[model samples]
Structure formats: C-alpha cells, structure tokens
Target: PADGRPIVELRGAGKSYGNVRALHGVDLQVFPSQVTCVLGDNGAGKSTLIKIISGLHQHSEGEFLVDGRPVRFTTPRQALDRGIATVYQDLATVPLMPVWRNFFLGSEMTRGPWPVRRLDIERMKKTADEELRAMGIILDDLEQPIGTLSGGQRQCVAIARAVYFGARVLILDEPTAALGVKQSGVVLKYIAAARDRGLGVIFITHNPHHAYMVGDHFSVLRLGTLELSAARSEIGLEELTNHMAGGAELAALKHELATVRGVDVEELPEEEDLTAPVPASSEGTS
Candidate 1:
C-alpha cells in the first residue's frame, strides 16, 4: 500500500488577510504511512497553514495538490470528500453524549422506512466497540458518556472514528498539548498506530520531544515562513529543540541575562534553583 507518493502537498503556499500576510511560500509533502511533524511557536503561521490545508482558508498564492493534481477546495466538506480529515484539539465530540452516540453522531446508522426511520442502536454500539478495539482501545463501557473518558481516550476515539469513516489523510492539531506524561504517551502510541495503518498524518505541535518520538519528516515554521524541512534521518532531538527555540537567538538572550546580573558566565553557580525566591533587585545600586 505504500507507493511512496505524497497524498497531499503544498508548493509555494502563501496566505494573506487584508494587508497582513500570515504565511509565506510554505512547502510541505505528506506521504502515506508516515508522520509529518509541523513545529512552530505562537504567531508562527501555524494556524494559517492549517486553515489552508483543511479548507478553512484559501491560499493567495501557490499550488495545493492532492494525488499530484492541483485543486482548490471551497469548503472543509470538499476536502473531507477527498479523504482529508482534521482532528482538532477539542476532539469535536459531545461530552454529554454516550460513547456510541458520539461515535456515530452525524453519520448514524438507521433502519426501517425513510419516513419512519429509527437508529440501529444495537449495530451501532457493536460496531463502535469493534472499531475501537481494533485500534487497541479498550473502553469500560460503550454506553458511558464521552465526558467520563480521559483526554487521551477521547483523542483515541476521535482517531478511530476518522479511520473508520475512510480518512486517508489525518491532520491532528496539538493532540498532546494538555495531557500529563502518561496520557501523552498513550496518545503518541495511537498516533504511531495511525501511521502504521497507512494513513498520511500531519502532526502539528510545538513540543519537540513529542514530535521526535513519531515523526518521519519535520517542518519548522517561524515568523510566517518555512524555516526548515528535513527527513527523520537528517535531524536529532537536541538539534530540533534548539531550532524551535530559535537557536542563536536563545543563546544571545542567555548571554544578555547573565550580563545584566553582573555574573561571569564561567564563575556562576552551576545550578540555580528556579523554585527559590528571586534575589533582591539591585536596580539603583552601583
């Protein structure tokens, strides 16, 4: 199933609103069975790029391609029709709704005549259980409200649902942002599982550790521009982390901080406890 062709691509992509340019000449290629990690800090044109891919906004310049052909999607539904599915941070499930109900919310199974249609509750519940189990998710009860599930569990459910509905491309936005250590690990496992199942996954996040764990390709964005792109083999965790923190810029800031505090870099204490109270300010002292 891995033909090595990109499922989607953006060449020289740019987006602008009024006189403000949010993105500039960004290029990305997403292939099946691979995870493409997009890393950027706040105001780094991340949201704008996501909008362009998910059809929430159109690019003002450059070519958007699906299966190596140029196309412009007028709406998110249009992209969805082409098997591009985006799983937002919020997960999009009704918290108060039962797991099975939320699983089939918009695309519910039905039985009986058209005018007298009724939900096929038994079938829906059984299918939801099977689908989730196939994704290695074992829920205590399918009848339980989705609100009762943990954040990682909810994210897994959303992923399983997207795959079940025939999504070939999965766009995940900050899937592990608010999760604890253990919960984040759980979600990362599922993300790898999704990629292994032959889905082209675009993982958007600022966490280098999380991205480095499962990424096959990396794209770093900064200040409305594409700063770097590399295959997994060309980069390491430390290098990726430094680039995200603005490499040289971070070093410059550290030097400035030490200078202002009148501390010789080589003579300073090796360990400064961040939890300790700040020393008194010497603003007016000689």
Candidate 2:
C-alpha cells in the first residue's frame, strides 16, 4: 500500500475569498498507512487547506487531486463520495444520544418491510461495539449517553465512525487540543491504529509533541503561508518544536533581550550561536 500512489495530493493549492487570500501555493500528499501532520498557530491556513481538501471550499489556484486525478468538488458530499472524510474538533454528534445511536446516526441500519419497518437496534449495537473494540476502544456500555464519554473517547468514536464508513483518507482537525496527557495518549493511539489500518491521515494541530508522535510527514504554516515541510527522516522533535515556536524569529527576540540585559548574546543558550544570521526585529523590545 505504501508503494502505491498517494490517496490524495495537493499541488500548489491556493484559496482566495474575494480580495483576501487565505492560502497560497501549498503542496501536501497523504499516502496510505502514513500520517501527514500540518502544524501551525492560529490563522496559519490549516483550516483553509482543510476546507479545500474536504470539499467545503474550492481551491482558487493550483490543483486538488484524488488518486492522482485532479478534480474540483462542489460540496462536502462530493468529497465523501471520493472517500475523503474530515473529522472536526467539535464532532457532530447528539450529546444526549446513546453511543450506539450516535455511531449510526445518519446511516442507521433498518429491517422489516415498509408496513413494519423498524431500526435494527440489535445489529447496530453489536456492530458498534465490535468496531470500537477493533480500534482498541472499550466502552462500559453502549446505552450510555455519548456526552458522558471523555473528550478522547468522543474523538475515537468519530474516528471509528469515519473508518467504518469507508473513508480512505481521514483529516483530523486538532483531535487532541482539549485532552489531558492521558486523554491525548488515548487519541494518539487510535490515530496510529487508523494509520495502520491503511488510511491516509492528515492531522492538523498546534501541538508538535502530539503531531510528532504519529506523524510520518510534517509541514509548518505561519500566517497563512507554509514555513517548512519535511519527512520524518529529515527532521527531529527539537527541530519540529522549533519551527512551531517561531524558529529564527524567536531566536532574534531572545538575542535582543539578552543584548538589552547586557548579557553576552552568544551565551544566551540556543541551538543557533550568536553568529547565526537572525533577521532583526523592530518588535524585539516590545
């Protein structure tokens, strides 16, 4: 599966909202059994790029490809039809609904004829339990309200739902943003499971540690533009965290601060020495 072409690819993708350009010339590829992470602070065009790929919005420039064929999707259904599914931070589930009900909310199983048609509750419950277990998730009861589950559990439910529905590509938006250490670990485990199940995962997040945990490829975005892109072999945790934390721009600020304090900037303790070229910043003092 890894030897084949990417499930989806974006070539110089760009998006514009009238006079405002939210994204520009961005390239990304999602291959089966690999997690591709898009890391950035807020307003870094993560959402914009997601929209373009998930079919919520169209790319104004460049190409969006599925199975190496360029295409434009007019609606979310179009994207879903192409086996691309996006699971957002706030999962679209009825909080008060039972876990089994939520699992098959829109695509529920049915039985009997039109005169005596009825929901296949037994089959739904059994399938939901089995699916969750397959993803290494264990729920005490499927009858409980979904709202009673923890953030990570809820995220897992959404992921399982997506996987069960035949999604070849899964785009997760900040899946672990609101989770604690243990909760985040749970989510990351399922993400790895999804990757192992041969789904191309695009994990969008601001946390480098979380991204680095399950990511095979990484890309950083700054102020709606790409800062850096690299495969796992070409980068490390320290380097990934550095880019997420502003890289050289942050070094310049620390250098300026040390200079202001009359402390030798060279001894300020950084990956880069004082001689390294750091672009001067007027806002370093402020």
Candidate 3:
C-alpha cells in the first residue's frame, strides 16, 4: 500500500476463555486502500479475533492498537468512536424498515431540538441514496423495505452506511457466506469500492476465492491459531485455498476415504510442500 501507517495493528494478540485459548499471538496490519483478509474454517478463532477487534471482547493476551495508539476498548461504541466500524453477518437491520430508515437506524439524523425534534427522513433518504451512488451502487428506490432487497443489496447498504458514518477501518464478517456466486461477486465489488475510497478493510471469511478477488493481504487460521500470513504478492489464490483447506490433511483424508471405497489409496496424489509465508504463530508463542 502507498500508506505507510496502518490504521489497525495487532501485536501478538490473543484471547482465552477459561483454559481454552481461542487465539494465540496473532500479528496483523490493516492499511488504508487495502483489504486485509482473515481466512479460516470454523473454530479457527476468526470469531474470537473479530470480537476483540470490534470491542465485543478484550484480548486476554496481547496488544490491539488503533491509529498508533495502544488502548483497550470495552464496547463496540469505543471501536466505532475510533472510526472502526463492523458489519456483521446477521446484519443490523429491521426487515420492515425502509432502506433509508435501516441505513440510519441507530444514528438517525434529527431536526429541531428536544420535544420538537423528529427524524430528518427526507435528508436521510437523500443522503443514503447519494452515498450508495458515491460507492457505485444505484438503487431504484429508498422507500422500499430493506428486506425487499436482495441479500447482496442489504449487505451493500450496510457497507455504504459504514462508509458514510466516517469509518476509517471497516470490519466485515462473512459478507458473502450466505449468497450465491453472483451475489457474492456483488458484495466483493462493493468491498473493492470501499478500499478504493481509502478505508482500511478487514474482511473475514472462509472462502479464499472471494478473498483473493479483492484482498491485498491474507491470513489463514486453523484450530484457533494463525497458520499463515502474507502479502498478496507473496501468495497466490491456490496456495491460500490450500492452507484454509489443510492441503496435506485433506489429501490424507482422501486416502482414508479411498480405502473404504475399495479404491487403491496408492493412486492418490502425494501432498507437496505448500510452504511459502511463515505461520504467524507457533507452539507457546503467546
């Protein structure tokens, strides 16, 4: 990235619950105009890391820094106050609310003061429409219920809202997990749009293909540990997909399944060394 300073940085960041550690010594950097992708299968500490970064959970072990300041956050609002906005997978929206209403739900613009104040509906509608267009998204209408829009559109609306609210770092959790191939592409397009607008984006997903399409940095986790981390120039999509899928492990599993099917396991392809970027964490790192 052209920007030398990272908007968000994690130094040996880890989280633990009771005796079980969900993350261990994870180092990451999020720079403006770049998408830092965190790829991992289920239970790979992605959720735990997201919680810590979003202020839903504090790191039990290491450092979380925002804008060169070393600080701990106790709530999501604190993270938001620092210009780090998160768009969750379940979405923060009311199904029956109009697109504009959902766009400005918790942070609605108001007119007048005290008892005389009311929602500035028209201004919000105009702003929402404009912001979406600014991000290269054009909606037919803002009066339609948000639920009436496709999943891709709703996710795009949430992303547009985050960008409009002055978010400097955007953390998106599985934005394309529920969508089909086409809809996933739609979300990816907006993600690129956000990056082009100069926001540091943290995109969390298990799909390497989707991540590769727009990511500038990649990190893969497995069993709550950071298994791989590298710049886009240092890694390719196939290597990333292999890491997330456990390249050698998957091959071994295939061997076992082949035996049950009465097929010769010896014919299975041999696992090759996929090593390139070093693992971000190792045993007892934290």
Candidate 4:
C-alpha cells in the first residue's frame, strides 16, 4: 500500500513496437521524497517503460495516473505540462552554448515589445547560477560551455533546470552510466536533494548499487516482464543482485564464461567482479 499517496502511478501498462512486446503489464508507483528505481538489462524494456511514463510513447494498454487521477499524454510536451519532466541520459543541451544559455535554452526570457525582443541575459544568468547552487551544483563559470563540464555536472544542470521549470515528477534515464565513482555520487546526492524538495523521482538505471543507495522502491524487469517489485526494506542488496543477474540469462552467461576460460563452474572466480561493464555503445543512452 502507498502509505500516503503516490505522485505518479502506472497500472498494467504495456507497450509494443510492431511485433515486439517491449513492456507487459507493468505497474509502478512514484512518491515524493523518494526514488523509485526501474532496473533491467538491455532490451528488458527499460527504455520502453520510461518512454511510456515520460509521455514519449503511449502505452498500448492500462492507465497512467498523476496525483491520483488518470491521464493520457500524447507527447512529451503534454507530460511536461502536467509537471512531469524527463531528463534522458543524452540530455538535450547544446554542448557549444554557455551553461546559462543551455539552462534557458528553449524557454528564454525576453524583454522589450514587438520587433525589439532581446534576451534578458543578466536575469537569466543570475537565476541560473542561483538555481544550480541551490541544487548543490557549483560551477566555476556560467559562461563556459556545458560540454566542458563532466557527465555528472551536466546531469545536475539538467535536473536543476527541470526543477526550476516547475517539474513535479522527474524521470532520469541512466544518468550515471558514464561517470566514475565520485561523479556518480554527485548525481546521487542531487537526486536526494530533489526528493527532499518533495518531488517524485523515477531513476532508471542498470546499476543496482546506485539504485540501492538512493531508491526507496525497486522494480526489476526481465525479458519484457516485471520480475519483482517491493519496497527497499522488503529486499536486500544480495536479493536484488540475484534477481537482476542470477536469473536464467545470467546462468547462461556464467556457463559461457567458465567454458571460455576453461574452468568448471564450481572453480569460477569471484562473482563480484563478474558484473559486465556496460559497453560504450550503451553510453549513447547516457
């Protein structure tokens, strides 16, 4: 049961891409001041699920709820209008533009009347700096291009921008996949900060460690189906890891790795390091 009420909820959601069933009968809930993590392997319908929640794609079945009311979003704009903002790993910022410009990219403030509209640079820069600082993002220079920042920094800026724009529910898609340990921690802290501000957050990632650190609720998907769902207290890290990797697919992978290394399964090396590194190709999602 939702102790209070969820800011966002999905009931029996499903999506299909032609002949391929991407997500099937998935139910999810997102509450304020908490992170709801959606974890899955590649092609396990993580992308499809996020798309449906963020209004990038319409579910073929089931209903989406916001603030306890059912709603249908035909486009991402509709979702944003409902105060649901999505920050994909590849955030839509122009790398060459200054951080201030990127922060106000599409929604720039303007002064003067017709035929004399000019950007309110001073106000925009001041607000951008203040907002970023409030979100625990300290930048050396607001004039610097966003590309100059690390992956975590850019992710922070995007999150801050979304919050500043009046987002009530924030959906992040694999935000920390490209960052190092320290950088990932920065993003996780800001995520907590967002939750503290009473915004519901949906954290989409393949990293269980990261999820466990910030998430209050967890949902695991495998082969386009929901494998497990529960509060953090209901499951431990080992159980979560096993659910994610100790499944049939991971058993097959273990057999393959042992065979290739010419070792028996019982003689296998430590399973801790066996977690596969997300390849560079997957970096495109970040």
How do the predictions measure up, each by TM-score?
0.89, 0.89, 0.91, 0.89
Expressed as tens digits, the lDDT of each residue in 84-183 for candidate 3 is 9999999989999899999999899999989899989899999999999999889998999999999999999999999999999999999999998778
Whichever of 2 and 4 has more TM-score, that candidate is: 4
Overall local distance difference test of candidate 1: 0.87
Look at candidate 1 and give me any clashing residue pairs: none
Tens-digit lDDT string for candidate 1 (1-286): 3576799999999998999989999999999989999999999988898888899889999999999999888899999999999999988999999999999989999999989999999999999999999989999899999999999999999999999999999999999998987788888889988998899999999987888888999999998999999998998776777678675555566677785756566543232211222223312111
Better of 1 and 3 by lDDT: 3
lDDT of 4 by residue, 1-286 (tens): 2468888898998998899888889999888778899999898899998888788899998888988999888899999998899999889999999999999999999899979999999999999999999988889899999999999999999999999999999999999999998899889889988988888999999988788888899999988889999898898766787678745665677778775756567754445544434433222111
N/CA/C clash count, model 4 = 1
The candidate 2 region of ten consecutive residues with least summed lDDT is 277-286
Candidate 3 residue 1 C-alpha distance from true site, Å: 4.2
Report how far off residue 128 is in candidate 1 (Å): 0.6
Candidate 2: segments with Cα more than 4 A from true spot: 251-286
- Cα error of candidate 3 at position 217, Å: 0.5
Off by over 4 Å in 1: 251-286
Question: Model 2 over residues 61-131: C-alpha lDDT tens digits?
Answer: 99999998999999999999999999999999999999999999999999999978899999999999999
Candidate-wise lDDT, in order: 0.87, 0.88, 0.89, 0.87
